[model samples]
Target: MNEQLTPRQLMILVAYFIIGTTILVVPSALAAEAKQSAWILQLAGTGSGLMLIALYVQVFKRNANSNLFQINERLFGRWIGKGISLTIALLVFVFCAQVLYYIGRFVTTQIMPDTPSEAIHVLFIITVVVGMRMGIPSIARTAEIYFPWVLLLFIFFILFIMPDIRVNQLLPAGEFESMSLVRGALQVMSYSFLPMFVTFASLNAAYDWRSSMAKAFVYGTLLSGVMLTVLVMVSTMVLGPDNTTTQLYPTYVVARKINVGNFLQRVEVIVAFLWFILIFIKLILYFDVVIMGIAETFRITKHAKTLTVPVGLLIAIFSAVVYPDYVYQQEWDNTTWVAVALLIGLAYPIALLFLSLFRKRKAAAK
Candidate 1:
């Protein structure tokens, strides 16, 4: 059971988790709101994310012996704790489905406009199920091996896109409104960073010591934050505020702009490859969490391999029907989705932390 995610492994896990679909879609989402200053909002969002990780680490320290489910049970009584655990399990399930939906959408719009979405969905699910059956150690090790390559390509893409950057495009400083920038940052924080709470389920891989937990969460969040900011920079500088806001995949557009010579045309292939790696890792992690949550819910400590298919099938079907089309998906993510994530992702863990601390104080006073 001790996959024992090293600092290196945790950092990559978190970087993948944060960057996933957001890098593809968020520039448009943020630009639609904050315009030229979206990169500045991204910077602020990263700081907000760092604070949230600090909060999560504190909860982990207080409930050192418990996984997320056990922590819920300890914080509330049996029935209520089970209820909360079930709710979280459902959230994790929906989470995987949403990520799946993004994969389908990306493939259809960005890569192969003619390919059927369901075909992509089925193929992706097959890979995810196999990864889940193999389990976290395999997943973590695979990430360890492949993450560096993705990172290198990402760095290459950023450097590749630089010559096209128009310094004047980011000027004017949101001349119309400043509040939009604040909202933009909040959206970015919720969409990208706060979801890291999902890591609570597999946190047993973290070393038992409090500092180890801190190292894993802090380093991971910081690294992912840097990646997000770099992506925003590239998107805004190259595409300009108006075009960045209107495009479906601003970063991909930036990649498409890369052309050193006629020989190097269409190297946006690197973006596609980078995204496929990152999104696949994100989907697999959430898929694994759903299985883990079920085991914790029913106390099925033994063989939950039986649970994988039902969950995977459920997610695949749900993903297909989740959002009718790209426009609605984009709207929901910017407006409703962040609110939903905040209520569950932020609400549950912080409440659990408060209750645990209160109970600890009562015990000491007695």
Candidate 2:
């Protein structure tokens, strides 16, 4: 693995990873709680996300050249750190399965209703496994390649849907309950930001974590945050809060409204394509970090690729039962996921940083 990712590539990966499943699910999720003020929740979430990225940058600064697994070992000693690393790896593995389930479900319900979700899971997992086998350089490069197309499609989606936006849809904005806004913001952070803990593992692939790289990280978050905010806001204004809340993928539905002269109609596939790019990048990155974390935890550097197929198979199996039903999924996303994301993405890093400072002080005294 003599691979290195440029800052530009890192930026693209971060942006795509943040935008991944968020583009589809967020509008409805936010609308459910915040209603017309859903976009405000997104703004707050994104702001907090930038703050988290700053914290991550500090963590990376303290533990330069080491991935999250190695950082755990360095901060907590060998066995305990390995235990922690393995746990995090397993959590990410579960996330991979969840993402796989998301894509499979999306396709079955939205695109190909006749196709079995299991088939979609298997097919998508194969691509992820293949991408992982190619290593991070390839994955980063692929993201860079797809970045422009994603940006263009998103811009076009916003532009074409402008005509359908109803200002009155957002007329009663800022009228939500305080708890509802808090919950909505937390949900947005849980889905769009907190899972970025995986990026700590990816930092090892970067050429350098210099200031430029740090800026790239923030830039990625900002770009994705703006895109998500706009998407959420537009969904509410165009589809109304009621429609956005009721639909599973309000953004996808919004795409159906892109009718420029009727000739440019029925381009909902563009939304799907954009999501596939973002989701695939995110899925592969998750899979990559899972493999890396496990290998580093066990010192299996030479044969990490060997674990790919077995891992892929397990993810596929897990996808089959990740959710008992969509109702359960919604419950899990709103409630369970926030706690889980906070644990892994927020609390875990803070713990490591505190330990790092404690060790530094002890060493200084010695």
Candidate closest to the true structure, highest TM-score: 2
Tell me the TM-score of each prediction against the true structure.
0.94, 0.97
Residue 160 of model 2 has an lDDT of: 93
* Model 2 C-alpha lDDT per residue in residues 30-143, reported as the tens digit of each score: 898888999999988888888888887777777777778888888999999899888888988889999999999999999999999999999999999998898878988889
TM-score attained by model 1 = 0.94
Tens-digit lDDT track for model 1 on 155-268?
888777777988888887655466776787788877777676765544553445634657876777778778887787778888888888888788888898898765677988
Whole-model lDDT per candidate: 0.78, 0.86
C-alpha lDDT of residue 33 in model 2: 83
Off by over 4 Å in 2: 205-207
lDDT for residue 357 in candidate 1, whole number 0-100: 84
